[model samples]
Target: MQANQSRKTGVLLVNLGTPDSPEVPDVRKYLREFLMDERVIDIPFPNRWALVNLIIAPFRAPKSAKVYKELWEERGSPLKFYGEDIEKMLQAHLGDRYFVKLAMRYQNPGIPEGLAAFQKAGLSKIVVVPFFPQYASATTGSVYQKVMDVVSGWQTIPEITFTNTFFDHPKFVEHFATAARKYIAERPYDYFLFSYHGVPERQIRKGDVSGHTCQFGACCETLRADNRLCYRAQCFETTRLLARELGLKEGTYSTAFQSRLGKDPWIQPYTEDMVKKLAAEGKKNVLAFSPAFVADCLETTIEVGEEYKEVFEANGGSHWQLVESLNNSPLYVELLADLIHQRES
Candidate 1:
C-alpha cells in the first residue's frame, strides 16, 4: 500500500468510444451522446438536438446498429476491448509508478468515470493521452474539454496535462510505416492512400489560429507553425513521414479524408472519390492506411477496411488492403510511456 502510494501520477487513455451493445437502443444512445456534443456538431443546441434526436439518430441508429452487429465479436466491440486490454498492458509497462485507466469520450467507460478513478486514487498529477495521432477540434480537442469539465468540480484538482498531437512522432510514424511495409512486401500496390477521418472544413478553419491560411490546397502541403494545429495539415504531414520511412516515391501515395458526416463539406479528396479515381486510372492494387485512430475501431476495421474496399473494387480496383491499427502493440505502449514521461518533464 505504501509503495503504491509513492506513485504520484495517473494516466488516462481515452478513445472516441462505442456503443455498449450492438442493439439499436444502445447505438441510438451512443449517437445521441456523440452528436449532441457542441464540438462535434458545432451548431446551436436546439438545431443540433433536433437534428440528432429527431432526424439523424432516429433514422441512422438502426443502420448504425446493423453495422455494429457486424463489427461485434465474441468478445464484443474491438475498440472497447482493445481499450481494456491496453489499459492493463500500459499499467504493467508503467509499473508501480503510475495507475492507468481507459475511458471513452462517449458511451461505455466514460471519461467522467476515468477521471474519478484518478481523483479517488489521490494522485498528485494526471496525464491524459487522447488516442488520436493528429490534433482535431472534434477529437483531441473534445477530449481535452471533457477532461476539464469533469475535473473542474473536484475540490482538489490535480496538476493535469494533456498530449496535444504526436502525428509525426518517430515511434508513431515507425509503427504505421512498419505495418504498411508488411502489406507492401506481400504484393505490388499500384497506389497508396492514407485515409484519415474527415472533419468539416469549418472546424478546420475554426481551429486555425491564423484567419485565412487554412484554404486547404497548397496551404496543407507544408506543415508550418500557423497550420500546425490544423488537422488536414497534420494528416498530410503524417503521410509524408510515413511515406519517407517506407521510401514511397511521390505520386505513388496520396492523402484523403474519410467518414465525413452531414452535408457540410469535409477536408477534400474524399477517400471514396480517390479510390474511384485510382480505379478509373486503372490502378488495380491499392494499400490504404487510417492513421487517425490508434485502435481498430469501426472506422478502421469496417469503414476503411470493408466499405472503402468495396468502393475500390466496384470502381475496377482489384486489391484493397487496410494496414491494421496499433492496438496494444509493444511499440504503441512505448509511445504512450514516452508521452507520459514528456509531460512529466
Candidate 2:
C-alpha cells in the first residue's frame, strides 16, 4: 500500500525538433539528423546517407533555413517554445505525484535527456506522448523507437507506455472544431480544407500487415481493422470528426496531404493541387485546417498558413483562412491529462 502511494510517474512530451536557430548551419545540422533516420527516408542506409548528405542536406538546408527564419518568433521556434510551455502547464496540472518533461526527438533537450531526468528522479513509470495527432513512421513511430533504443541500455527499466494515436479522441476533435467555429463565425467560407503532413505511399503499404494494402482511394473514407495503423486512414478519420463537429457539409469539405518530399508518389490529392482545384472550381473563400499537428509549427504557421495562402491567391481564390492549432489551450491540457490518467488505470 505504501509502495503504491509513494510511486511517482514521469510524463515525457516529445515534438519533432527544430533547428537551434534559423541559420544555414543550424538548419543543415537539424536536417542531417532528421532526414538520416531510417524511418524517415526509409531507404537503404547507404543510399539514404548519400542522398541526404550529398544532395538534399547541402542544397536544401539553405532554402529551408530561410523559411525557418520567417517562421521564427521573438522567443524562438514556436514548436520548441510551445512544447516548453506545455511542459510547465502539464506539470502544474498534474501536481506532486507526476513529473512532466519536454523532449525533442532530434535535437536539444532530446529523448535521452528526458529519460535521464526520469531516471534521476527515480520514477516508477513513464508515459510518452508524441505531439503528432496521427501516427506516422517518421514521427510517432520514430519517437517510440528512439525511446526504446535509449531505455534498452538502462540497467533498471521501468514501466513505459505510449499514447500512439489520438486522432479520434473526443476532446481532440472538439478542440479543432472549436477553433474553426471562431473563424466560421467571422464570415462565410466557400470550402473547408483539411491538410495533413504527407507520408510516402510505400510506407503506407509497409504498415499494412493485414495484406489488404492502401489503394489510396475511398478505402481511407472510414477506419477499419486492416488499415488501423494507416496514417492516411487516421488523417481522413480526423477530418471526418472535425467536419462533423463543425456541421460542414460533404461537398464543402475535403482532405489532402502536404509537405511531401522528393519525386516519390505520396498520398493524394496534394494540398497544393487541392488549392488549385478549389480556385478553378470558383471557390473563392476557403478555410484550411491542419489537424495532423497539434501545435502551430512550421507546417501549420508557415506552410499551410502562408505558403498555401500564396497558392490559393495566385490561382484566383480571394479569401483563405487558416484555423490555428491547439497550442496551449486549456482543453488540450485536459486531453493530455486524460491520456495520462487512462494509462494510470
Candidate 3:
C-alpha cells in the first residue's frame, strides 16, 4: 500500500540529498534543481540556468562525480546512510510508539513521498528534522515549505513540529565538538576554521528581522530576537558559542563559508581564501570544522577534507585537518532521542 492512515507520532529525518548514481546525467539532474532553487541560488532565472547548465553542469558534473565516487561506500551516500541509521536508532529507542522515516528535500524519498509513507501508516503527528544545525532559508525553511506543499490538500494535517536549529543544543555541541576535540587533541593547531556552506548575503538582508540588524557582524553575535536564524549571523553565533564552550581563545578561531556557487557575493571570509591566508601567514597546523552538518556528506568529506586540504598544503601549510561529522555517534543518537523526549514531553 502507498500509505496507511494511523494516528501514531511520526518522525521524519530530512536532509539535502545526493543523486542515486554518480553518472553525469544523474548528477546534472540533481544539480539542475538544487542550484536552480531561488532560495539556494537566489539569482535571475536566465543567468542561474545558463550558469548551472552551460558552466557548472558541464564543468562540475564530472569533477563532482569523482568526489561522489569517494563518498559512495557499500551503502551509497553517507548522508542517506547515516540519516537512515539515525532513524533506525531513534526508532529503536522510541519503540513502536512512534514512526520514523527519512526524507530528502531535493531528490528521491522527498517530503511528499515521506509524508505519504506516514500518511499511509496513519500517523497524525509528525516531526520534521532537516538535519541542519543552523536554520537557513535554503535548508530548514525549504524543507518545511516542501512538507507544507505536500500536505496542503490533506483533510487533516499532522501535529507537525520541527527542531528548526540545534546549534545550541547540549547534545549537538557535545557530539561534533567532542569529535573535533578528540581529533585535534593530539595535534598542535595554529587556528580553527569553522566553515559552513555559504548563502547569498542578500538573503540575510532581505529577511533581516528588523530593517537595521542584518549587518552580518554585530547582529549575529548573541542570537537576538531579530537575528534568530540569519544565515550569516547564525553561523557566526554557532561558531562563537561553540568556541567558547570548547575554550577557544578569540584570535585562535575564525568563521568562514564554503561550498559557494556562482559570482554573487556570499557571506564570507571564504574558506578557500582563509586557507591561502593561513598558509601565507605561516600557520602550519589548521583545523576545519563544519558545524552546520550533523552527518558527513560530500560537502564535509571531499570539499573540506580533500579540496581545502590541497589548497592549504600547496600554499605551504604544513598540516590541515578535516574533522569528522557526527555520524551515528552514540551521543548524537542520544541527542536525537533527547529531542524526541523533549517533543513528546
**Residue 109 of candidate 1: its Cα lDDT?**
93
- Better candidate number, 1 or 3, judged by lDDT: 1
**TM-score per candidate:** 0.98, 0.97, 0.93
Q: Which stretches of candidate 3 lie over 4 Å from their true place?
A: 1-7, 44-55
Please write out the lDDT profile of model 2 over residues 1-345, one tens digit for every residue. 111344499899999999999999999999999999999999999999999999999999999999999999999998888888898899889887888889999988799989998887788899999998889999999999999999999999999999988888889988888888888899999899999999999999998886676788978988988788899999999988888888889899999999989999999989999999999999999999999987898899999999999999999999999998989888889899999999988
lDDT per residue (tens digit) for residues 1-345 in model 3: 223343378888888988878777888888887887777777799988888889887888888888788888998888888888887787778777777888888887777877887877767788877788888898888888888878888887778887777788887777667777886779888899999998888887877757888776666667777777687877888888778778888898999999776667888889999989999998999888899887788889888988999999999998888888878877777877777677778
Question: Could you arrange the candidates by TM-score from highest to lowest?
Answer: 1, 2, 3
Clashing pairs for predicted structure model 1, backbone only: none
TM-score of 3: 0.93
The true-structure Cα RMSD of candidate 1 reads 1.4
The superposed Cα distance between candidate 1 and the true structure at residue 179, in angstroms, equals 1.3
By lDDT, is 1 or 2 better?
A: 2
lDDT of 1 by residue, 1-345 (tens): 222686788888999999999999999999999999999999999999999999999999999999999899999999988888888888889899888888999987999988887887789999999999998888899999999998889899989999988877899988998888888888998889999999899998888776889888999889988888889999999999999999889899999998888899988999888888999999999998999988888898899999989988898889999998998788888888999999977
